[model samples]
Target: MDEHISEAIGRPDLIRLDDGLLCLRFETMKVVSALAAVSHLLDTGVVRRGDTLVDSSSGIYAYALALACHRYGMRCHIVGSTTVDHTLRTQLDILGAHLEQMPPSSSLKLDQNRRVDRVREILRENPDYHWMRQYHDDVHYLGYEAVAERIHARTGGGSLTLVGGVGSGASTGALTHYLGKRSVDVRLVGVQPYGSVTFGSGHVADPEIIIAGIGSSIPFGNVRHDLYDVLHWLAFDAALAGSVDLLRRHAVFAGLSTGAAYLAARWERREEPGRTVLFVAADTGHRYVDTVFARHQEAARVQDLAPRPVRGTHELTLPWSRMSWDGSPAPEGALLRSAAAGAGPGDGRRASKCQRSRAAGEGATSM
Candidate 1:
């Protein structure tokens, strides 16, 4: 079949946000990664005709897998968070994906925990079904090699900083590893919701924020702590302000994670004036219009009373504590937590399968 959209996946447009800041539009980057992972399953005979593809995602990865399964003729089941609303539901339905969504959780951690639990249950019942393990699998990391190559080519080896949410570690982690392999001075800055369990943030039994697709309640195996040089944690209102300001200023309607990264990257550019600071716009804001904009309509009325400024000045800069990583190996006791959580190896057996294939270099199966 002659492909169109998948062919365009991972090819990002470099948008000059400021004099030195750049926004790499990468809505389809995950699709490129997801396609590689899906193709790996099909070509390796690990999964074949009539086999189902199972994974847990908040929204974007689920949609990416849905697209891949549509093109490859495989059954897909997505265990989703409540943020997977009717808009995403309609798209997945069109792609023939069965979505089982969890109720509205106050935070991404709870949602992820529940979804991972559901995914494990499905894998147990249907052991033959190939679970994509988007969160814990190393194969997803392999999917971003081309992205790193493009960024390297785009910058022509000038010093650069990568700014993005450390979700699943596929995009940001893999990009840093690949770029660093070329001997490029890659300064990696990680952005996460204030309540994420990743990057030294203790898991809140119920975090106040639920920034999906970026922050995680659980430790992601693919996320390499050593790859990151700096980190920032943004609260819900802070990220929401950035998202709104991005649309207002740049007219680029991006997701919440993008805004968070954008805010981080903008600040980084000011701090590191000599480097070309590049950040990611993961997906469009069409999905985030409600939470990031619509629900906050009351702000207009309040704007008149206080004559409010453009963006609410939140944590534009991280405190000294948030800036420096502990330099410790693991997150206090991630192993003990994982064991008590009963999520086995890389969260589950499915992740183990993906890691094995990645180690064997099966992701490089050519066209």
Candidate 2:
């Protein structure tokens, strides 16, 4: 008995895909974070029931925030990336959230920059509006604590390997953080798109589209680089193979990010036979039906595909690459500069070491 549709949608189903592999599937994952964030704002008097909240989103977060607003009796304004499709637009419209989509751009970097710029302009015009800052604020991590509890309870609190896209870091990072608090030896393997700066793969461009929700063109303040144990950078074709294989083999039709995570999880599970491996499927396959499933013929066999092991970001190559990121800090050239400089809208402060640690500490308290 969920109180709202958001609660129902946010709850994930843990499905066993193999002997040691599990899939945590969600209809739309960001709803977990969005609902908790808005409720916290209202609870703390930072925002009221009717105050408008704004942020830049590509797709999932836009719908999540809109639903959150609808549930909590608030208003949502989304500055959306060019990837926000007609389906999502229609949903936002019906949900009463305002959406301002960026003009079409082939470059994901440009699209992301435009969305952030638009958000800044909106904030200037409406100073009273609160920016959710999903990529930076640790408040988004609060909701995942309950999710972690579920995982721990189901899995019985042992050494487990968690694989998922290193998106804004709320999902995987928060899960690992809370699980570790309960003495679970959680090995976090982060999946990334080639052009994502989150883990310094921006130098190597993906010829195809950067997988929207899994990675980011700009630096995300919430991504805890040190939280990841290993990193895999998968290009569009590799992820397509993964998505196709996931559906064909396990009957789990999920988004591109899930495909990437599935591919990574399969490898990690094969490599470490002793540990239980679970990956996050952030959304369903409906959005990717045309872009991915339609071109299933071209996808490489998941059994035949593997990531090229790289010693460092400098060694990262084309279709797929993997590197050991065992508790490492952000790379030297990534958006650490922009984050420190507060280069864009909503990135109010430098994510200095002390500040990031303090944010993580505060998040732990919520758990």
lDDT of each: 0.67, 0.83
What's the lDDT for residue 288 in model 1? 71
TM-score of 1: 0.81
Q: Estimate each model's TM-score.
A: 0.81, 0.92
Candidate 2 residues lying further than 4 Å off, grouped into runs, are 335-367
Per-model RMSD to reference? 7.6, 5.1
C-alpha lDDT (0 to 100) for residue 271 of candidate 2: 89
Model 1 per-residue lDDT tens digits across residues 1-367: 5474665765677888788888888665588788878887778888886679887777788888888888788899988877777888999998899999888886555666777778778877888777777765667766677788988888898899889987766788777777877778888888776555665555332233546777665555555655666777766655666777777778888887887787778777877899999998888888777667785543222112111111211322221123644223335422222221111122321122112122211111100
